[model samples]
Target: MALAKLGEGANTGCMTQTDDSLRDHFLVASPYLEDAGFHGAVVYLCEHSAEGAMGIVVNQPLEITVGEVLDQLDIRRERPDQPVYAGGPVQTERGFVLHRTGGDWHGTIPVSDRISLTVSRDVLEAIGRGDGPRQYLMALGYSGWGEGQLEEELASNSWLVTPADDDLLFRTPDESRYAGVLRAMGIDLNQLTNTVGHA
Candidate 1:
């Protein structure tokens, strides 16, 4: 399985909430975040901890299609029209599936009761056969941060954090996801400034 190469480092672990953890949240890239890959991105954070953080860029679709991936793995595509996502900047070759159903698949990690992340081929096989979770997004690679790295970025006002919503994750159009999230938070993009002042 190509996903097995991700190894134990990719495990999502149990869904444990901490005062500092951003798990099950959305990280919206601030306009000040000049990184081209993350600019205007809406990231679904799957894990966050004192150790680090991991997430998928939910709104960036690659040119590749789900059908192409199924063909590569020899899995018959029951639904072939979905686009694959560029999950993050790290491990561009690895694949991760953010799904909305619980199943005992290999390398499956629970993000929440309604969401999970799976890195094994069995889930893909099931999707090909129309037997997988009801809704899913397949992404290649994921965004990650080392200990204190994300905190430093947060302190720098590089991102805007919001509670994750299923509608935003699965229904919003890719082109507008970043703006949509901001709107949902009652924020006007034009009103935001690059400079954040401390009280």
Candidate 2:
């Protein structure tokens, strides 16, 4: 669903819906999103269907350190070294928790149930206590797809889609997610053209 919004460029316009009809796909950036907020973004397809897809830009790390945000909330990182991600352009001041599930810590968005998104403040407090999920990434915003938006993008190849892995979501280094997702598709970053437009 994240790639469905590829209407912003050319590669998306040339794609056909049949190109990808599977579940839990990843959106691989084309190496040209120069915007500091989205440069080399990697998104996770949470939902993809005829209605359209919705995703979260998981790998775009923001200059805002987790420790800094903690200060904003009057809390401090249990581990000062934790990284903070851009999430997306929405709710830059809000927080979203992308974390491992099936643990004793309940109450989440139940993205896949196995993988959940928590927008609650409690997650933050839990993190401060060092009693949160096994692994997690904190993001400032999120990405969304409207009905029919993703389908059109798939036809244009704006987003190179591939399977999603929980390990990758929780463990992949933020700096490498964009290219890393492409690697999952066995693609070379140099092979993608920066030319974006509707074919």
Candidate 3:
């Protein structure tokens, strides 16, 4: 698959939430984050509100394949080689599919006009039958934050927020999404330092 390069946009330095909703945004883990699971992760925020936040880490491809997952469920696999991702730290046994909007699946949440997140088995059934969305990533688990948790992290510079792009979410290779999002936001990954600026 050709990795589409994202177009450059304003270099808005590290962003902290104001009043805008972060749903459908990209949560790029700061380089200094000490958590091993999230290092270099690019999370696609599916739900973000005053109560809490939920997202799936899109760039951490596990050694497993979608076929492997379906096989465990006794579902037939037509696309066996597609890589699966380690979505986050919660519910590792559960599966989540981040795909382009086109199917009528149960438990589907529209993340954006073009993207949706599905947790129901029917989506997987359709995929096993070779009738799923053309662009999709199957992941196990998802990142989550409690009320005011994400905002605290944002205030502490633990993450950088940017508008999520479909190509970056669906077209870019899993290994390249972190840098891809940084590039799109006019950020040079090498130039990012761990030092937090204080006013």
Candidate 4:
């Protein structure tokens, strides 16, 4: 499965705890997480288990557009312009698509009842023909945590966990998503601090 391929090169030696999976959740970067790559980032978890966690950063859109990517890959395009997100710090050369689940694709991993992750070009080809998933977030690369890395970070309060919302994930504006999640949780931005607090 495409999701299993995510751990192919990882050597974190993390356990595989399917029952404790955090799949389909959102990882909102806490203010205390000062890493330039993740500061104020909003990640949608695609797969999470004891082996590790993998997700896509949905709030950071690159200047490059879907049209540009299609042109670069020589895929015909009939759709309107769409921004491509910078998914994470790993595998930046590869592309990943998070879209509303429906059509069958060659390389697809279901993230939830409503979302699936596709790493093959066939979906892009379909999009080029105006027949892809109705809503999608196209990105390059993806955020990943090996072994217990994510747990340690969570222990240190680096991320605010929240249930994944389709409206926030697919329909919310990129710039507003970070605060939108907070708002949905009734959190005031000014109240956020390094101190641990449940979302």
Candidate with the greatest lDDT versus the true structure: 4
- Quote the lDDT for 139 in model 4: 87
TM-score for each predicted model, relative to the true structure? 0.88, 0.75, 0.86, 0.88
**Which ranges of candidate 4 are over 4 A from the true structure?**
1-17, 193-199
TM-score leaderboard ranking:
4, 1, 3, 2
lDDT of each: 0.82, 0.62, 0.79, 0.83
**Candidate 4: what lDDT?**
0.83
- Ranking of models by lDDT: 4, 1, 3, 2
- Write one digit per residue (lDDT tens) for candidate 3, span 44-128: 9987777778889999899999887788878887875689998888877667888999898756767779998777777888888
lDDT value, residue 15 of candidate 3: 23
Provide the RMSD of all predictions against the true structure, rounded to 1 decimal: 3.5, 8.6, 9.5, 4.5
Instruction: Write candidate 1's Cα lDDT for 17-123 as tens digits.
Output: 57878898999998767687787889999888887888899999999998898888788887766899999888888888888958778788878788888987888
Model 4, C-alpha of 142: deviation from truth (Å) = 0.7
| Candidate 4 least-lDDT 10 residues | 4-13
After superposition, candidate 2 runs with Cα above 4 Å error: 1-23, 31-39, 103-107, 193-199
**Tens digit of lDDT per residue, candidate 2, span 1-199?**
1121111111112112334444456776554343454457788765555655556788867777766766777875677557787767754655667777644433354555567666556666677777767788877766665677766665665566677788678787876776677777787676664444422
Q: Write the per-residue lDDT of candidate 4 for residues 60-142, one digit (tens) a residue.
A: 99999988888887889997488999999987877888999889877777777889888777888888899998999998888
Candidate 3, lDDT over the whole model: 0.79
